[model samples]
Target: MDSLQPILNSIQKFQQQHSQILREASRVAMISNYIPDEAFRMAKATENLTRQLKIINSDSIQKAFDTISSIKLDLHLPSFPKFDYLEFDEQRLERITRHNVSVGWTLTGDMPINLYLRDEYLDMEHDEIDKIFIAFYEEDEYVQLKTLIKNVKNGLSEKWSEILDQSLDLYLEGRYKITIPALISVIEGELSSIIGSSKYGKRLVDEFHNKLDDKMKFLTIAAYSAYFFFDEHLFKSHDFTHARLPLLNRNWILHGRDDPSAWKKEDALRLLNTLSTLQFIKEIEIAEN
Candidate 1:
């Protein structure tokens, strides 16, 4: 209805440079220890291109709003918080213990793979109920684990959509900064409720949320991961992490200035890509389980 054509056209313009975008995306996918080095450099270059374009078309602000509104997102958003962050069920902890698996990792860790593995192990234990760890742990069992994760993820996806819708509304209404925390609280509550609803879902979701809360403790930071994409237009360089480069680039490019670093697009995107890829790896590991 908003003539998605303009937004689509802009994305198409960028898509024309698909080769570069894909390269950046690839680098982003494996920006972690798993990927090579040459691609990292290329990602930086592409990121610069995005930054320059953003600067040239300061009007990109409008285009961004228009494009975002035009897209037919499949995500299901959650509702606004009934109360404040103080109202969330912070007392509750994940049902899964860290000792259940051999990885010496908890279900709650920054790397989603860790949670994915933990979830897989939990599902295995759940199905067998009495089998010793040695007998149940195997490469093939990953399929069942993934199925369980998918169930929880599907439920959470509905929540993600809600979070996005609320955040977008606040953003469009010019209340983003002021109201974002409330939206984040809603997101946390939704995830908490979903996790607590099912044994398997609770195990996986709690593990993930606990880890996130430990590190950042803010729902807004974690929620941003669900929808944020890479924006290569900011910064000249940054360090590395295990994330998707495009998404990282977009995050830093869009918000890096809010950080004191004035972060380099090249470095930030590389690191962000690594982190994103790691997230994907975690998803894959969970899916496989």
Candidate 2:
């Protein structure tokens, strides 16, 4: 993926360079119309004039950008497939759920209560969640996976924050080359631990199927990730509420834009937050809790 950074940077540079060319050509076109026949024929001036505009109008530039940006880059954690949640027994899940429930209760209380139950639960559940947040590789395989996850999550989240915030500028201006892939890389890199988890891979893939699109495949991939981790079910709620859902009706209903690739970054992040939070709650809620 390091190779991709340079290519992306080049795309940005090319866009800026060509934009200047386009502006100059437009000015030349205006001047040529009024200038006498002499300047128009001076330096193969007809050819030069047409050539500049042709370069500016070439569809290949935009198509090239679209192709590179659309190329899917799966940012899976290296050891994800080995960590299987289903391997744990029902009793283990119950234990983890009890821990999560106790923590939820304790977090809500004002004064200190007998949090021994809560602490016990949180400690055990924390181990599992930590494994999901960080990589669950052999201890020797990753001496500082915990620290790595923390740093990466912060950096990656901030990176995607910028992309989502500027989605409109990139798309509307035909600058997909500079924006789409960047958003994908940031989101995938940030959420790799949970996104790549074997426990949730099927779910992630399922969501991707629903959101996939060609024009904005990079954004679509990112959006699916948002929904994968942060959808509505993760939070505590009596039932599904319209306001509770991430990006609820924003595309197909709100804007009538069914194209998933066109979704803004914040919308994608909101979806991810909703899905992930709901998933966390559902995974913790046992038959008893």
> How does candidate 2 fare on TM-score?
0.19
lDDT tens per residue, model 1, 150-269: 333443445445444444354435444533333323333443443344322224344554544553422321222331211122111344443333211322333432332432322221
Candidate 2, which segments miss by more than 4 Å at Cα?
1-88, 94-185, 188-241, 245-289
- TM-score leader: 1
What is the Cα-based lDDT of residue 144 in candidate 2? 28
State each model's CA lDDT, in order.
Answer: 0.32, 0.32
Candidate 1: misplaced stretches above 4 Å?
1-155, 190-282
Candidate 2 Cα lDDT to native: 0.32
Residue lDDT tens for model 2, 60-174? 2334334434434353212212212243233543443344332221111011112111224444553343333223211455432222233333433454555544543453354
Work out the TM-score per prediction.
0.22, 0.19
Q: For candidate 1, give the lDDT of residue 125.
A: 39
